[model samples]
Target chain A: MARVYNWQLGREMSYWYPESRPKKQFAAVFDTNKCIACQTCTLACKTTWTSGKGQEYMLFNNVETKPYGSYPLAYDVKLLNMIEAGKWSGKTYEGQTIFESAPAGERVMGWRPEQVDYSYPNTGEDDCSGQVDHGALMQLPHMNWFFYLARICNHCTYPACLASCPRGSIYKRPEDGIVLVDQGRCRGYQECVRGCPYKKVFFNPMTGTSEKCIACFPKIEQGLQPQCFVNCIGKIRMAGFLNTPDKARADNPLDYLVHIKKVALPLFPQYGLEPNVYYIPPVHVPASFNRQLFGPGADAAVETYKSARKDMDLAGLLCLFGCSESLMTRWKRTGDIVVGMDDSGTQLVRVPISEPVHVRTSFDPVQKLVRINCP
Target chain B: MRRRKLIVLPALVVLLFVAGCKKAPVQTTEVIAVAAAQLPSSPTDAAWDNVPEYLAKLIPQDLVEPRLAQASTPEVRVQAITNGTDVAFRLRWLDSEQNDTAKPGSFVDACAVQVPTKLMPNPPAPQMGEAGGGVQIVYWRADWQAWVNGREDNIKSIYPNAEVTHYPFQAQSLEKGSPEQKEMAKRYAPADAVGNRRQSPRQSPVESLLAEGPGTLASNPAVAVKGSGVRTQDGWAVMMVRPLPEGLAPKKRTSVAFAVWQGSNKEGGARKMRSGWAPLAVEEKKP
Candidate 1:
């Protein structure tokens, strides 16, 4: 076994392969507050890939209502319950991960889902916690709260799918940290499906093989964002390459949201895979509930996002979201506007720190004159 | 140190036994030639009642098993006879539980007989074969038999409460030659495309497969073999029949291997109970 540092967990973890970092890791941050549960991202991913036979049930990108909904039903909840039952604790999770919890001869701890478990992809949709009275007025802290969570393959540093493949068919690309399953080498064992806690890997019964999101490597190679990232109707997603934790730059939008401002946090950091996708927690929900979904940083992240207007750098970085097709490697505050630059130092997008507004004109019927109205 | 040596010695012997050692005891059978009129057509034929039985020991595939465990069906009885046209072999193994269905996360009971295509200096690797070794296998699956016999149930039959109002592919108005219809048809079994409708009775459940090496197993489209299996109170009685391929002289000494899968144990792929190559001597007819 070899040990590698997981920045999300803030500790070292064991992996079967030697420590080898990718040149640049595919990363993204989703602002959950801005999502409207439109599912355009899901459709974009479905039409681009996973439209073949046996992939009818696969949704590479799914927007699910948190505290209620999940694609494979209670996939995350079941695994999270297992971890909690196993007494997972500590800031760095001193307890066993799924890899370390395997039985004597097994390579990983996994459970094969029943066929019935996959019958329904969207169960308990939009079911929120708490009830509301007929005449009660709602305030900042509402009685019932739910948020849409847009999820895609995290392309983790330590992937469970890569570890559980006995035939060594699954591999992580060194160029961009994209995990992929080699179709020729795979024998349709479905071990990766069983081992993945997020349940992202899907088995193609027609071809008798397993497949998952490729991170749109074909598009990424040409400096284009993935379909899910570019086609998001909510404009809540930002895709970019994340630097290693030790080498993170403050100018990078991903780094600014995830590290410097610390307004975005990884989901289930206790899983110990160091997932690349980060989330800005919804502010309306209770801190404990947010903490259960995201890690201990959820409370702090929500607080930072609530006060983002006062932080000019944070406000400037937020302007870069949904800006361009090419990933922004650097950004700067120029006067009252933020300029996003690609790796070649080409300005891809320019947005003001605060968007400009225009007043509407009201028509006066009797005088047949237009009157300008201001807020 | 002396006590540790004694403990290690027995384990080494067991390991060698499981490793397909030639010194391990093997049941040898002599194939007798019978008149075409007197040859038995089925495994339960009365003619097979008088044949000599050879007992072969089946060992667990420790190389791929989840743990190093003993074989569930340790011993199997075998007998063989041949007519001028075809050769038939009967394999009887003890498995009290009948596992004949395949579900998600579950496997079906199966058995296979492997013979090399050509003579070699050393027999091919018992785990399929090495490249260029050219191993031909006759595989029998219980689930396939159930499917052919109309005893297998579809998804709706398994989950009765599932609400499936309509399937778009089943629509009659859709043009059969349209691309949308063709794409929808891919969801059905490959047999459906060729008009071999499901739940139809067939002559045999066994399929002919060939492998040049591990992970190279493929179904032989030639349809050169046929077999059937019957489940009894004690175990399964399976009989496989095929034409004796060229290259093997009638009286020459050759060998064949046997593998059995107990579905209840979740055995498939490389995880199975198998016997090392056993000597097979076909006797010539008397003038």
Candidate 2:
């Protein structure tokens, strides 16, 4: 094992291979507070990629209700149990990562779920953390709490799937840091499926190989976001590139949300994969539970997210989510409008700070139709 | 002196007991290879019954990464025969379940017979040979055997519950069996599109592979290797046929290795039970 630095753990740790980051890391920020779990993003990804035979059960992008819901039934809780929860002192994690805690002959500390584990993809769909009593009313810090967690492959800096492949078939693309299974070289070992803690990589029975989310590379190469991000009904997703902390650019929206504002945090940062997909923790969830799910900065992330309106630059970047299909490499706040710019300084889109609302009459005179609903 | 004897006596006894308890090295016996007019094509052919069976003890492969600990299969009864032009090997192992599908969370029962390309004074290591001393492998897979035995090789056959709403390869707009449709279908099955032998349709139950070390196994030129595997009451009886190794003639000795994988135990690749190189003494005449 080679010792490499994991910024998420705030320390250097052991990895199977040496640290060789991509020229540009494909990353995204998902605002958990805005996700409604409608699964439009799920369907969008499904129809676009995994509509084949062996991938019948694959959901490259899925939304699960946290605290009681999970795809593959408790994927996080199972791994977390094996690795055991570790302590975090401020920004530094004082714990054994999945790699550091691996068993004698194993590469990564993980458990492979049985086929039956994937039988129920929507288990505990809308279940809350606690039951509601009769005639219960909403209040601050209510007993019942649940949040939607939309997930895709994190495309980690040190991908467990890439590390665990004995055939050396799985590789991280040097161009975009997209971890992929070399379909031609893979012998259907399914080691990646077992090694990945998040259970993103899936075994394709028909092709006799493992497959995962490609991060919509074709669309990305054409300067567009992924299907799931573009089709998100809740507008909670924004896909862009993220740089390391030392090289974090303030103009980059992903960097602004992840490094500068510190509202978006990587999931299970203690795992030490340095997953690129960041999340803005749900504001209403308890800090303890959120911390366990998102890492030590969950409480601070929630605070910053709640007060996003005060920061025009931050709020402007958040408004650009799902605003356009094209990828915005950079963003800036100009007056009351936020301009999304490409890498070549081309403006892709512009969104106002506040949406304009014009009240319509109850009855429409032009169409001669009665309006039952008022907007 | 008396105290010393008392202490040393018990210590000697403990040492002897521990040595006895440890597993002894498997006897690498020289097994007889029966001569035949033509090598038997079937595992259960009457010709195989005439040959002596050599029980090769299997040990977990601990030489590389992803090693196995005490593989489920402990031993495989091996029988070899030569017809000058070709050599055939029959391996029978006890397994309760006949696992023949390679799917999600599933593995296939497999076995391989490996021989050095040239018979040398000192043969290569049994762990898939060493650097220059390459080993030619005739690998037999239960799934491949099933495919050659007329089992359908399609998604519907493997997964009855599969709901394929749309597959560009099977799109109604594309004419059936057209080159354009095949080109479009290649996108869904990347492994098959890129010509992965395991994913492509095959008529042979065994694949000819060459290996010079761990993780160096790859396809070799076709050498007219044939195989047949039959499910017996207790386990599988597989017959593998291949061209005779170099420097092996009638009334001669060569080296060979055997490996077995129990699919139910999730064994494959480096995680399977293997036997060290064993001597194979070929007979001059038919038994």
Candidate 3:
């Protein structure tokens, strides 16, 4: 065991191996407020990568309606309960991580879901917390609430799957920090499937091994966002590189949202994997519920998001999302426009933080014509 | 005085018994490898009748990581018959379930025979041996036996209704049986594309593994170690055949070890029941 710095926990914690970060960590920020549960990103990833013989149940990217829904049944709730008692002590978590909580002779404290656990990918799809009684909303506000939660492999800085593989098959790519399973080395042990708390890694029975989301490295190498990020219907996703706090740059869009403004937070940071994908908590969700899902920062993130329109830098970066197919390494706001640039400072996209508004009256006097919209 | 006489009476009887003994009682179990005209190819082979059988008691392998949480098989009966060129050993053990399918969160019945690669005045540690003195393990699995028994290794074989899509390698995506189609199919089956031995077709039901200490098991699929397993009424019976282990021949003294995994109990990899090294005393063939 080695003590490594987990930035999410804001303290050094026990990890299987010493901390060694990638040169450029592949990362993304998802705006939960903008997501509408329209699974365009899901089908985009499904048709592109997971539509195969053995991958029938594998959803590399899935959007579940949260508060009453989950893929693989209750993958999140189960893990959250397994590694329970891990409460945050202000910024630093005082509880043991999955690695630290592992029992004698085990690498990580984890449980493998039964084959039947995967039978229902969308078990509680679109279900809300409370029921609606006919037209109750007309008389009084309905209590029901749900939000779309789009998920992909977090590609952690300290990947539990990489640590639990007895044969050392799963690895975090040092170039991009993308966790991957080396197909040749893997022997269908399913230790990775058991180790991952998020239940992202899946066992492909046809191939007799495990497979997970590759983060679309091919497109990333070609300087483009992944298929899911580009195809997001609500423009809720932005793919970029995130830097650690010590080296965070204001120009980097991921760092700006994740570090500078400190609005976007990693999911389940208490698990101590230091997951790269960050999420801007939904404004409508209760702070208590959001805190458990995101972290102690979820309340602050939601508050910041509620006031985003007043902050041009925050609103500017949100506009730049899903506006381009190319990956933006650096971004900046200039007046009403947000310019997204590649690593070489080549402008990839220019999105206006505020859109121009033009309204026409019902009657056009000059042409002696009456114009009515949406009759 | 009476208590002393009672103790000395038994002691004098034991002294007479000790003086009558021809040689010192053998401390280690000597598995006499009776040189045979032909090795036993299967557990039911008649050639094994002429060879000596040694029953080894098994204990849960809790020495290393991923320790077996529970006990499964209690013991295994071992027999060895060797030809000059090749040696074959038969392992029979008690198991209630004949689990021959490998699935996620499930394991298959398996057994492995470990033979020391480096020999000398002192034998290596029985737990996969030491660094300089490694062990060559011939591992056999029930699922591989199913494969050798003509079971197709595909989704349809396991879940007949599973995975009915236009195979990316087929007509809809690419021309069937074309080079491009083959490459496209490999995309879906990454393990097979990279030639992971587990995903590849099985000619024999055994894998030849080399281990130098714990958690260092490595196997090359190219190296052939032939074996077969069959489900018995009480348990399982398996036969492992390979070239004579490094330093074994007629009139040679060596040792061997065994390990067993019960699939229904979720035993595999480091979680298993194993036995210590049982000395082998090779004997010349009778005319």
Highest-DockQ candidate: 2
TM-score of 3: 0.91
lDDT of 3 by residue, B60-86 (tens): 887776677778899888887778667
| Candidates arranged by DockQ, highest first | 2, 3, 1
**Residue-level lDDT tens digits of model 3 in A1-375:** 899999899899999889999999999999998998788999898878776667778888988887756777778888777788488888888888899988887888888888788777765465443364563223323237778899999999999899888778888888898899998778777878888888899887666788999999999989999999999989999998889999999999999999988899998888889999999998887788898888889888888888998999999989999999999998888899999999989898898887888888989999999987884
Clashes per candidate (backbone, < 3 Å) = 0, 0, 0
List the global CA lDDT of all models: 0.72, 0.85, 0.83
Question: Which 10-residue window of candidate 3 chain B scores lowest in summed lDDT?
Answer: B22-31
DockQ of predicted model 3: 0.39
Interface RMSD of 2: 1.9
DockQ of each: 0.11, 0.40, 0.39
The better-scoring model by TM-score among 1 and 2 is: 2
Runs in model 3 lying further than 4 Å from the true structure: A129-143, A367-369, B1-28, B221-223
DockQ of 2: 0.40
Q: Give the per-residue lDDT of model 1 (tens digit) for A94-155.
A: 66666666665455566666666776655545434334445333222323678889999889
Measured against the true structure, the TM-scores of the candidates, in listed sequence, are: 0.73, 0.89, 0.91
CA lDDT of A295 in candidate 3? 85
Whose lDDT is higher: candidate 1's or candidate 3's?
3
